[model samples]
Target chain A: MSIFINKQTRVLVQGITGKQGSFHTAQMLEYGTNIIAGVSPGKGGQNVEGVPVYDTVFAAIEEETVDASILFIPAPFARDAAFEALDAGVKLIVLIPEHIPLQDAMDIMAYAQKQNAVIVGPNTFGLVSSGSSKIGIMPNRYFVPGPVGIVSRSGTLCYEIVGHLTGNDIGTTTVVGLGGDRVVGLNFIDVLRRFEEDPETKTVILVGEIGGSSEEEAATFISSSMKKPVIAYLAGRSAPPGKRMGHAGAIIERGRGTFESKVKALNAAGVEVAGLPNEVPAMIKKILS
Target chain B: MKLYEYLGKKLFHRYDIPVPHSKIVESPEEAAEAAAELGDVVIKSQVLSGKRGKAGGIAFASNPGEARKEAERILNMRLNDLTVEKLLVEEKLQIEQELYLALTVDGALRCPVVLASLDGGMDVEEVAEGRMIKWPIDVSIGLQDYMTREICRRMGVSGALQKEFIKLLPKLYKMFRELDAELAEINPLALTPDGLVAADAKVTIDDDALYRHPQLPRVKEKTDLELKAEELDIAYVELDGNIAVMANGAGITMATLDMVQHYGGAAANFLDFGGGASVERTAQALELLLGTNPKVLLINIFGGITRCDIVAEGFVKVRESKGIDLPVSFRLVGTKEAEGRAILEKVGIKTFNSMDEAVRHAVDLTEAS
Candidate 1:
């Protein structure tokens, strides 16, 4: 069984009328995600991919149960959309937009915690329960239903690794994109905990990059608690110090989140860290065998 | 977007946080004039980087002539690769005690954290962790009065000084929240004979939130290529290497850079065209990559939302228009891979579906060159 989402999970699309929202809504629908309703303040009474749209999340939830909400709202309006979804009692939020204000992200996370909900990203590609459901903007072609549970911070990098895995006849139980924001909803440990509990997930593949203590923290969690074998592929080892390598969170700051530090931590935790993406599938094969 | 000391102080003053009397001057004459009016001034190089004090970017001036001389020396100085164009000429304060206070977002906690230290003026990072008291502020509740008081008490601060800190901490928190600041810092919250005065300010507003605060100056601490990339809406970082690397996502782009290095080649720069890049945008990104004039260009696209065909079309467009001179290694996969590969093939360019093969080829080309 997959974690977080499956075929029966009811999803709500926020800002459904927007370009990204409409496009991904069709993609998610095509992937057989149970999209119950859409929310676009003024564009109520419309249907996107045969799903009904409402003025507010409250109005949408009044008709059907929405287990999760995927937002495609712009950076500035993300806070209000997320708050509305939380207030409407939606437990899971998948924020797709990048460059969301740091303050808004913090406030959203704090609010989500208070409401007993989970947020996926402010700059994330969302998540997928392979073969069962898709709630993110990942190109559906690469993922397949299998034993490995994938958790990553980068969308394309995850897709790249998944492509290699799928090419080698391996599949995934679930792929969780934790986002590349400095302040995001869920982290490595949070997703790893779920991966550990999932019966279908025999092995966990962590796709980490340079930045933050998340990888190191994940390593600590894996060593102490995780029963499943974990393999990792960390990016940006060649990154220069003090330079933000594209992602807001992907930077070496105060010598804290260096590549060496993360690699050492993961190695100490007994996780085989792949030097390259293509090397991961073999590592996973060796462990599973 | 790290604001200069002068700008940070301006924001501090606006927020009613007590700061030393200061004037920003671009020239030595202006520095001398401001010092003559202010009396016993400190000429500080207005730069964005830290450790400027150690770089001789800071100097004390007891009189106008000394201020002018110091300003001249500083204005000509380059601290941390940044040229000192402006100087903050301010009245020097007699420090009774030095304390550190800052409000920054704690990534792990996903909340704003207030860090207070009795030891100040020196690097807070270098200070013992025991000396610094960190309190994570609940974003929903914000910075409470009791939290600040508790922090002061934990740091052994009491009496009139505690009261001043109690009043000042909230203002700093407020500034941090309202300005959408990533970090609002006072390195040396000095206690002078008069009262508590903020001797230094290092405020960095979130670049994402810059749109909301239009009044704040957009500091250009980037290279010309970086600035150009910003204008082109491409995420780019200049590096000191020979191979120019281009990729679709930030994570993958970094991985591509790592791969290049792993294969014994250094990347000239990091450029991410971002997701769902159109044919034109891809062509533009190619042009920007070419502008770096690297020995080789490595284009790695794990096409998901970003279509391989579109990226291929961009390559063809650039090849047809400007004519690419340097060797290019293209790795195309994911959606419409065949179509993208065919497009590149029609233009007499072969593509590698495997990232390893493509990266190795790029590195080999760089070595051969």
Candidate 2:
């Protein structure tokens, strides 16, 4: 009853022999994710945690059916890995590396669109559909299956807020980290529309930040056609202007992507916007009741 | 990551882009000497931030004496919070038209966008009111000649002028891609008597891609604390406060800063170790945080790819090596959470899983101090 993934969603790990890829591959396995294959160019005949490793995604797809892929490739090689996955007919991709070159990200985005596939991040923690399955690197225990579908542009901030929501017994159907980059694969609008269509997701939580206009676009979408109750929280209210606050996309430029502008947009769209992350649960509770 | 005007011009020259002759100078005497060689110069205060024209950072000097006087005035001036330490003395152009040209990523379009306008020599923000022509380029095909011609024609360029833009747009796009630059800009591509030349250059290379570009000049625009953090490979932004804040991700760090301010506490800096920080890297981050001289150190870790036990070890390593004696609050969660808490507790460091509780404790401790 989740949006992107569940128990039946078979997955593969790209760059699975790397340190991070190996560690998280084991973690995802322990979380009961339906991992089917692993890809490492040189170590083709090897096996990582009982999953067969192949030289390429196409070679891996030759033996088994993989519905999604989690990429742990280095930033420089991430584009090629992504293109290979798309070319192999894998529709969903979770890119874990940060600091990917902007041009490569653009190319990946265009290529993914042409294939009608979904790429989650160029810099992200990935996604988890509560107890059903997890494709990202987020700590899965903090989440539980429920009606609230979460979408965010951040990683740890999403974790902290989800911790608060789950602590208060407000579980989630799916939580998506839209990534913390300038040109991400999927944005708030795309995730929001998916959540709106999912029957299990009655409420949605949109976590946005300063720097880009994705939140503004989400506000426009919510105001016009959204039917589900949504609560929004934006970070970087006190962040200094112009300086990039850690994230490449999390910056204020030419007086745009300010906290004031995003808040105003969300509020004008008849959406309840929490000034602080702690206020999210209360706002969500009030709306659902 | 942001190159000064002189440096940007050097890059422009290397890429065969036409630029006005320029030389960088620190002292007024040096400026005078350079201006004498290139007469009728423009004395531009070399600061990273834009809008130098409005800040009076750009001055026209017809003579070497005027250039010297202008440099003296500007070298001691502060524009947009950045002090002018250097000047770019360049030959002034006999301009006929000013056009804007930039290659940057368009977040909304999810592609590289080329922006052009007939009106330039002004901040693009000032003229974004429907006067600019924007073309989002498909990265696979790149900035095609037809797209360039269409953008130039829309910007009111025609005939020879349109052809010039078509030739230059791809070069700009190439510079942006080759350098891994976030922005490759010519604010005023002046149509001078000598033909179209870049009057001003604004190039910003991605800090993450600096490893790929060893030839690019490393500008020291950061403060002492920021520079130290950069050495440790941590993202740090200095702020005016007494409480130093650290986190695993940007969004959480920002939220932590906001929460500290909400509780009447100011954060001294914003630092993120990113994901999957090793023990030594974490220890280095902690050591760098202490360099800020804060009243209290607030460490917030929400481990996803980053394990909490490793972060806990980083704290202990810093405490043992650097002899940290300041009041510190720790918020640790996810992957090996209990083990992380136990490690911190063994070292007499109390840990809280709740971010709110940790922030509140840190603010209270700092306020008491």
Candidate 3:
């Protein structure tokens, strides 16, 4: 079974009526997610793609048995939506907004943890639980049900890896995006631990990039307790120091954050590291074979 | 999402925390007036970004003439990549104890952390090595009484300042919450040799939360450059490159930039129509891209929300509409991808599906030129 999302996970869209919310909700419905309800302040009585909408998250929660909430709300209201979801005791929250204020993000993170709620992003594309359930905005065609569990920081890189794997007939169980924000809710280790315990997940593919000590922390976690064979790829190998390659979190300042350091750490920890995105599926195949 | 230092100080003043007496001036006339108000003032250029000191964004003026010159220099100049459109003239404080105080998001710990140090001004980051007073403020419950008390004890701000500091901490937290600020900082809280006073203040508000803030002008030119071309409407951040990129949607633009770097080519600029861009907007984009004077152009689009033919038509019209004639490369996918290609193919625009091929062609143009 997929860890965070599955067919059993009844979901609610916090911003069901907005342009992004409506589009993704329709996509999730097409992908077979149990979208139980939606919440928007003014458009409560309206329906979005056959799903009921409520004025408040608390109101929506009272009416439906939803396990998780996917927030497609804009950045400014991200904290409010997350807090509302947490107050309703949602087990998982998928936030698909970028450029959230650092203070608001920090508060939301603290609030989510206090309420025993786990959030996926403040700048993320969401997650796809193979063929079972989908949350966020990741392209679904790239995935197929398999033993490999994928966790990545980049949204499109996850798609790039899946494109590489899908062509080779390999698939993923659950692809989790920790988001490419500097201060995201979930980290690599957090998703990895969940992957480790899932019986359906025998192998893992991690799509990491240059920046932060996240990859190092993941390497340490894998070295200590992980049993699954994991093949991973870290982007920005050619990226020079003191250059930010678009994503705010992808910058390598001084000698602290670089592609080489991450690759070296993962290799030392027994993770079969793909030198590039194209090399990932082949490495995973070689290890599994 | 950053508010100016003066705004932060205004909030501080409302909270009863002492901030330096300051005035924000727009013109040279106003600059002189502000300096006169302060008497012995420090004329500081007010740009949004940091590293102002390095770029001559901060200067002192002894009199009105000097202040006007400094303001004139600052207003015309870019400081930390942001234009210094305004200057802050503040009554200089008597130097005494300088300390750093900030409440920010600590990524690793996954919490709201309060950082304070006895040292401030130059090299504060150096002194923040290991023993700085750090208070882990809870996000939902906010800064508890005990957390602030412990922070006060470590800061050595006890006695009369304890109650004042306690009141200030909550107010800071409140301001952070109410404004949706990313950072609320008071660096070198200059005590004027008197023991306590905030010399400088900084605030950064979240831009995404602007739905409620109607008066908040998007500082970037949300200009009516729209009539010119779709390319012009797109926010362009010029980079050191010969290959100009025109991409639909922000994410794809980012990917195109990465792919450009991967193929050993630097991106000229990042231009995005966001989503659902039209023909007029596309031509506008082309005109803007051509302004960079790049050797080649890469137009990457996955037309899910946008039509390929519409974008292609815009490129064709760029020469006629904006008088931009440039060698261009493109990769069009998703809706009407074939039709879009036919239009571009007839016009001699280079086309490729693989990002690898597109980047290679663009890099070749740069090398040949």
* Native contacts present in candidate 1, fraction: 0.91
Candidate 1 C-alpha error for residue A207, in Å: 1.1
lDDT of 2 by residue, B1-369 (tens): 889988999988888899998888999999889989999999999888877989999998988899889999999888988889889999999999988889888988898888888889887888865779989988877778889878876777798888788777788888999988889999898998777899999998888778778888898889987888888778999999999888999999999999998888999999998888999999888888888788999999888778889999988988998898999999898888899999989989998878889999999998788
Those runs of model 3 whose alpha carbons end farther than 4 Å from true positions after fitting are: A14-19, A36-64, A74-84, A97-107, A180-183, A208-216, A227-276, B1-11, B22-89, B109-111, B161-164, B214-235, B247-255, B272-287, B302-324, B334-350
Residues forming the 10-long window of minimal summed lDDT in candidate 1 chain B: B75-84
Models sorted by lDDT, best on top:
1, 2, 3
Give me the TM-scores of chain B across the candidates. 0.99, 0.93, 0.78
Q: Is the docking of candidate 3 incorrect, acceptable, medium or high quality?
A: acceptable
Query: What ranges in model 1 sit over 4 Å off?
Result: none
TM-score top scorer: 1
> Residue B330: error of model 1 in Å?
0.6
Worst 10 residues of 2 chain B by lDDT: B122-131
What interface RMSD does each of the candidate structures achieve?
0.7, 1.2, 4.0
**Per-residue C-alpha lDDT of model 1 across residues A140-237, encoded as one tens digit per residue:** 87779989999999999999899999999999999999999999999999999999998889999999999899999999999999989999999989
Candidate 1 chain A, run of 10 with poorest lDDT: A280-289
Candidate 3 C-alpha lDDT tens digits along A1-289: 9988899899999989998899889988988899999999999899999999999988987888879999988787888888888888898899888767666778788888778888898778788898999987766567789878999887655665777788789988999988877788889999999999999998998887777788988999999989888778776664556544445467675466677788889999998776446677778787778
Better of 1 and 2 by DockQ: 1
State the TM-score for model 3.
0.82
Taking the candidates in order, what DockQ does each have?
0.90, 0.78, 0.36
How do the residues B113-166 of candidate 1 rate in per-residue lDDT, one tens digit apiece?
A: 999999999988798989999999998888888997899899998899888987
